[model samples]
Target: MPTLKELAKRPERLTPGHRLCAGCGAPIAVRLILAAADKPVVAANATGCLEVSTTIFPYTAWNIPWIHSAFENAAATIAGVESMYRAKRRRGEIDEEIYFVAFGGDGGTYDIGLQALSGALERGHRFLYVCYNNEAYMNTGIQRSSATPLGAWTTTSPVGRVLPGKTQWRKNLTEIVAAHGIPYVAQSVASNWRDLVNKAEKAFHTDGPSFINVLASCNRGWRHEPSETLKVMQLAVECCIWPLYEVENGVYRLTYKPKEKKPVEEWLRVQGRFRHLLAPENRHLVEAFQRYVDEEWEKLLKRCGEA
Candidate 1:
């Protein structure tokens, strides 16, 4: 991994002056991932916050070759592009080695684009697929997605007289992708720059398919102050809600583990989405949330052989 000074010296791939929300983690994650690339890169972005915000009709924030694809075809689009690159290289038409990356939100990744993503991975495309998971469809509206955690409020999963927030736990997309026997798969967060960059470096270096699911905080949808974005994400990691880890060649490894895992409430209390769980009458819901986190963390530890 490059030192902070070394990383700062790399030319910016995702330039500023776009309209991404204040304190949005997506751009930060994108910049970090791109900075770790040692070669030229071509990126495909699914129709989501990153795509719409960064490229408004006449303007674009990307410094490298970029393609704007449909919400569910980022992986497929990048795969096709990569295939073309391979063919061109074989014909001696292209001499430079280039990396391919696809970016999508949770809505495009966990729900709409799952099929395309799955197929791309199964076909062994030499590319990196990054899912900037904000837990909901923030681009369209704050609608719940398969990546949304239980007891989190969203437009589709409202907390009212009928029931609480989202009733089901989030889909473990990282593990699902890893199950495809891909060369590399990881779960990272935007707040931890070093760990995220290290994982991005590995993902880019892998010879086969790689996927990194990064937790990107949505200040608008999450109903938190813009400045609290990193704080919220860091708490999520410390509480074991979003463990930083990677799976390489079917072997799981924990990259950053909290010395003492904090309670889930510490992570939930700051976000309005999970505010209801802190109510006196809803104390049990918090307990349920903790139990789920604990179980999932244990499962991950066991897989990494740390349990």
Candidate 2:
């Protein structure tokens, strides 16, 4: 097996010089997923950051066979692709070694395109559905999406006298996918390259559909410094704001464990979205949020026999 650095050295499927903003985490997520995918792979991408940035109608960054579908039909489109390939293989029209995969943003996966995703999973499509979750509708101008976390500020959910940015918690996409019993469902961060790549490899090896929600950072949308993107992402996991874990075959395990868990304030303070939490009342809410994380983590630990 190749070491982590060796894996990093693999052929660059997503070539450099795309149109992503500085410190955009979507391509970083893509780099890990494409590297982990086997050759002869066909990808169908939803109309979002990855799709609009890489494919500008006349040009494309994808070196492999790829398609750009609508914003809400990537899962259905890829399911069709997988079905066609399977049928072709049965009739000796194409080789059986090819893999099919789909890419979408949190908006595409959790809200607008959810029904298609559920249908694909229900039908047991042989593909991996990857959600590059930057927590909002970034390509559409950083608007609020269902995946946006509670208390974060988006343009649509600005912090004001009556509102503290987004008011609802992030949807539990991992649990939703796991409930489908698709054999493999995982979450990883872009900063954790090995974990992301290893999870991708595992998902690829699985016979049925797999879902991976990679915590991609949006430096511009989140109003953070470009250089601090990875730092903020790392802090999120360390502070328990975003725990890295995997759920496979109905089993759950937390992958990234901090030695001494830091306060959630460490993670929240870095982003402008949570600036409202600086107030006393909101600070109390933030502390309550930490309690929620601790509770969730404890439950997960119990699931993994670590509690």
Predicted candidate 2 versus true structure: per-residue lDDT over 46-113, tens digit per residue: 98988888887677888888987699999999999999989998999987597788999999999999
- Candidate 1 CA-lDDT value: 0.94
Q: Write the per-residue lDDT of candidate 1 for residues 214-245, one digit (tens) a residue.
A: 99999988989999999999999999999999
Clashes of each: 0, 0
* Worst-scoring 10-residue span by lDDT in model 2: 1-10
The residue pairs found clashing in candidate 2 are none
When summed lDDT is taken over every stretch of 10 residues in candidate 1, the lowest stretch is 267-276
Clash number for candidate 1 = 0
Candidate 2 Cα misplacement greater than 4 A, ranges: none
Model 2 Cα shift for residue 244 (angstroms): 1.5
The estimated TM-scores of all candidates read 0.99, 0.96
